[model samples]
Target: MVAVVTKRYQILQYVSWMEPVGRRSLADQMHVSERIMRTDIDFLRQQGLLDSSKSGVVLTARGRDVFTSMDQFMNEMLGVQDSEKQLAERLGIDHVLIVPGDADQSARVLDDMGTALAQTMQVMLPLGEQIIAVMGGTTLARAASRMNFQLSAGRELTFVPARGGVGETVAIQANSVAAAMAQSTGGTYRVLYIPENVSEETYQPLLNEPSVKEVLALIDKSSVVIHSVGEALAMAERRRMSDDILQLLRDHHAVAEAFGTFFDAAGNVVYKIPKIGLRIKDLDQIPYVFAIAGGQSKAQAIQAYMQHAPKQTWLITDAGAAQSILMG
Candidate 1:
């Protein structure tokens, strides 16, 4: 009976993450033979827990409900709820929401954490004239995609890029992240088309441009700000920074990077990129700040960055990161 339950859970879990994947591929992923895995697939299809088409297997509405309903149960079972409390207490953050699973172990956990953030934002977003500032990163991109936006209907929302993004992928750029979230919610968005790294001489004049001026004004008025934290070295690698800049970050013992600023374990600014958008200090003025991140690998980064987080910040992370943070 336990074996049956586990098999069923694995079937739903794999299908949830790798939908449209073939039966053979699923067998390979689960490390089971197709002949044996066939039984599990058949059970789900027969129970109407999955829709298996030539296109591939997908969860039905009922299946998704069954899957989602397990969120709390899994969190409790994994002691994630307790971990969240511990994390909030340790980090001095007002709230910490932890989704089940570690993103580092399972790609689906990232999706789960993203869903949690989107749901929270849907509830917390104000009713009128809301300006949302968003940071760019893969985690935030996933959050944007997972947004159901059902509750945001009839609400006015304007999304703005929190910082310029030059070397990053277009999909993870602050402009693209803002656009994606706005598109999902049927809201408006403004872009700040400037490189993330620039000299003070170049940044001062660009901020004065009419197009840049418009977006900057919106960012300044943002009521809610959403962003992701990154390990300083990882972010530097992503940006393809110069050796000198990388050395400087290391020399300062930078642990986390956010809003174009790097901070050490003590939360002091170690380095700053003169991006023409929102700054870390600017978050103090924003009423609602949402910091979305996950993965055990990012635990230190999250811890380091949150030291500078505003009092109103809401942290949404997965159990993997939370557990790792506590362990350290």
Candidate 2:
């Protein structure tokens, strides 16, 4: 009976994401036969939760409500609540929100995680003007993409890139993420165009630039921050770091990278990349700090960084990373 309910919940969840989707496509995605899927579809339609059209099946207004409530219900039934508390205590974080499924396994899971972040911001953001400093990465970009106008309807919010650009894909760069988020949420954004890692000779000159100084000031005043964690070597390689810098990370046994700081398993700062923007230590001053990352592969990196994370940091991740860290 429990298994049946779980399957039905998954079907509703997937349909909510991919409405107007065919039975064959849904079955293929769910890894089930069309005949079995048809049975579930018929049951849902009979219950008035789903309606069929020339295109495909879509949820009724009631179905939408049920889907929302069902998500919370299923999470509780599946022990996600227990996992959240346990993971938060174990990692010494102020809070932890673990969404269902492994993002690494399904693209929809990543989308769900993004939706979760937007929902959290709606509740945590206080009245009056607020600046949110955001970091770059595929994960952060997905979250930004999920942001809707309602997130900033009554709030005065400015989104600024937490750091300068890295040698990463253009869309996932800090500047891009900030812009996308601003556009989606009806907020304004400031861009920082300098390279994330720069030479000592160029650092001071860039800092003195009027444009850079303006953004830096906003970043320093930011009340909330949203960023992602990365595996140390993976991040270093993505930035196209020099061989010496790469070797330094390996030599120090760096396990994770967040913002510009790298940490080893012991949560010691193994290295700090030269960058202009929010430093990890500065998080202590911010009222709201959200570190978002997930995937079973990232369990170690998440565990390592959270060791040195601020006491106020709220980690938003998926079950894959949480289970891996807790079960280990």
Candidate 3:
């Protein structure tokens, strides 16, 4: 009986995440046979929790309510509720939200983190005019994609890139992430066109550009900031940093990279890339800062970065990362 309840809960959860989903597709995702899936679907239909059509199946009004309540129940059942509190207390951060599964083992976990982030924003976002600064990266790009149009329904929000491009893939650049988030949430976006790894000679000149200044101003006044943490060595290699800078990070034992700043396990700044946009110190003044990163491999990086994170920063991570940190 307990097993049956767990299966039904899993079905409801998946359906909620991917509504209008076909039976075969859902079965494939759940790794169950079509015969078994059919049985469960029929049971749910009889319960008036599901409405099926030729195209796909979705939750009925009662189903939606049940699923919403079930989410909290499942979190408690899985011990995530306790883990979230313990993690927050241990890390000394404002808050922590952990989704199930290890992102390192499954790509779907990343999408789930994105969903969690969207739901979190819905509750935390205040009304009235607001500016949101967002940093770019693979995790953030995926997470921001899950934000819906309704996120901006009652608020006047503008999304601005936290920094300039850092020679990463275009899809994961700060400007691109900001634009995608703005489109997803029905908000406006401002771009910073300067390069992230700028030299002293060119830094001031680019910062003086009217376009750059405009976006910088928005970032400075941002009420909320959404960004991701990255493994230090990987980020350095991705940015194609010079041999000397790479050596410096290794010598300093850098473990994490965020918003162009690299930190060691102790949270001491190892290096900071010269560029225009929001600085680490600037987060103190921002009302809300969302740092989203996961995967077991990122545990050290997440911890290293959080050590320097502002008091108001909220971390959204996965069980993989959270458990690793807790274990250590």
Candidate 4:
């Protein structure tokens, strides 16, 4: 067991920093010979801690849990000194988990939140036969990483991306994010193969396609929806909004954006981007809506989203953002 523990620790440490890496790099980092590193890696593979391919190595789903648990244990044992907890409590959220360091330290905090959110979905969602709708963002991507496929057993859950591509980054698109989450949960996924913003004339024709209509119908029937909130300015920048629309947002004092619609704190629609995806009214039909966002910068945007969210919605956010919301 001593050998097993040491190998696990070594593999965990290496993957934590040098993820998507190869066995050769792991050996070089540990200063161990290639032969020994190979042996250690093989052991970890047998234990399901390391997933290796011809290209590189990544932590398996099980391995992520081990690493996350260790980090959380160390942080709690060392104690957190951050002042963000007060902010979380004031926001009326269920719980606020804070990482006691700066943005660099908060990566793990975000990871933890993702894991918790995934676990929550696993426990709360009905086994099989549920439709889950998801939106895309950096926060949701992180949450996707911590999720595991084991939690979806005996469930026939179908995931559909709530919107379309926002920017050039393929990873942050709703279709890609929805696919990732579906894979993590051992469920199937459907992609919305269109941009978030399109002209009304373009959308009308696209809606006539059989595939688009099918996905749209599924989105309307979703029982649970998971999403991330975004600041209006940031989203505008991401979507490459026209100068006229930017000025319109400024005129309306828009603070937050969700599902192609921008809103101010009062829940009034500032502007609506013509996007070919799920409508805000569809969210109203869902029984459960889970909104996850973090970082101090997103506080106002999250607050704006909360103002418009249904009464049964649940929010998952970090202490940093929570504090900002409370202060505002």
For each candidate in turn, the TM-score is 0.75, 0.77, 0.77, 0.69
- lDDT string for model 2 (105-183, tens) is 9877777778777766654565569899999999999999888876674578899998877889899998999999999
Q: What is the lDDT of residue 251 in candidate 4?
A: 89
Model 2 stretches with alpha carbons more than 4 Å out: 1-79
Clashing pairs in 1: none
Ranking of predictions according to TM-score: 3, 2, 1, 4
**lDDT tens digits by residue: candidate 4, 1-328:** 2133334565687787888898788888878898998887776665566788877888987778756755543344224323334543454433334433222236776776676576556434555477888888887888888877655654677889886556636887788888888878778899888765667887788888899889988887888898888999888888788889899998899999988889997778898777776677766677767777777877778777766666545566666775566667
- Deviation of model 2 at 270, angstroms: 1.6
Clashes, model 4: 2
lDDT scores in order: 0.80, 0.84, 0.84, 0.71
- The sequence of per-residue lDDT tens digits that candidate 3 reaches over residues 197-222 is 76879888877788888888888889
Cα lDDT over the full model 3: 0.84
Candidate 3 off by > 4 Å: 1-79
Q: Which stretches of candidate 1 lie over 4 Å from their true place?
A: 1-79
lDDT of 1 at 154: 40
Q: Summarize candidate 1's per-residue lDDT along 78-111 as a digit string, tens digits.
A: 4555666688888887778888788888888878
- List of clashing residue pairs for candidate 2: none
Which residue pairs come into collision in candidate 3? none
RMSD of 3: 10.8
Model 2 residue-pair collision total: 0
Candidates 1 and 4: which is better by TM-score? 1
